[model samples]
Target: MTVNTRELSTIESTILAYFQALNDADIESILDLYSEDPVMLPFLQPAVVGANAVRANYESTFQLIRFEVQTTIQELVEMSPEWAYVRTDTSGIFTPIRTGEGAPAAFHELFLLRKMGNEHWQIARYSFSPAGALPPI
Candidate 1:
């Protein structure tokens, strides 16, 4: 789906900060961006709920490699006063902790975000996979 100019906002900037926090190994900063009761479903894991689980995931991934999330928000559809739907393509290079070798991973995700009324957005749901012909990225 394509999002016209009217649908675009500075949300992408926030998302970019989220990625920067991860790459900086700042788990706390990343957690701060999430809702207290957020839900995250990673490409390789079962659904993980709540802030604690989300933190754990970020930490675990950090242990594996430094993650750099490059996200392109493709569409933004407002759902309500506090909610919006976003589709994005995220590409990243994971630099392994031990060897510092990097592997690429790309994600195509559909996310739901709710405004917390504090100038912050919390993800409600995130689902993604590679394009049809390609294997999970």
Candidate 2:
């Protein structure tokens, strides 16, 4: 069956917008998609807390590399209308502007989302790691 864009939930739309913002490197728009107390756990990096830190993280990141990535929402579980979590897998090329080289990039991400005061969904906690092999289960 065909999916109707108009019928998409706020969380779904927000996640889509988030990926677009990432590709665009629109820091302002990226920050707009986060909650007041935002948290990010980037790959091989310490936890980044607060809006300012997140901003810095993205700033430094964009300076080093640019992502031409496509993100797929693997699963979306709604705990309620106010809270949810989205699992996603992103894969594409990550190009380091300094070297002008692009490499295969893949990651698995999780977003802990909540409805803000404006009744808009925003990410409160987000974490991602390399998508390849990990410790055996």
lDDT of 2 by residue, 22-107 (tens): 99989999999999999999888899999999999999989987878899999877776567899999988778878877788888
Residue 59 alpha-carbon offset, candidate 1, angstroms: 1.3
Q: What is the C-alpha lDDT of each candidate?
A: 0.71, 0.85
Global local distance difference test of model 2: 0.85
TM-scores for all candidates: the values are 0.77, 0.87
Question: Per-residue lDDT tens digits of candidate 1, residues 1-137?
Answer: 44444434645555667667867999888787676788887666799888778888877877776767677878877766677778888787756678776677777888787777756666677667744332222
**Model 1 quality (TM-score):** 0.77
| Best by the TM-score measure | 2
For residue 2, model 1's alpha carbon misses the true position, in angstroms, by: 17
Q: In model 1, which runs have C-alpha deviations exceeding 4 angstroms?
A: 1-8, 128-137
lDDT measured at residue 132 in model 1 versus the true structure, 0 to 100: 32
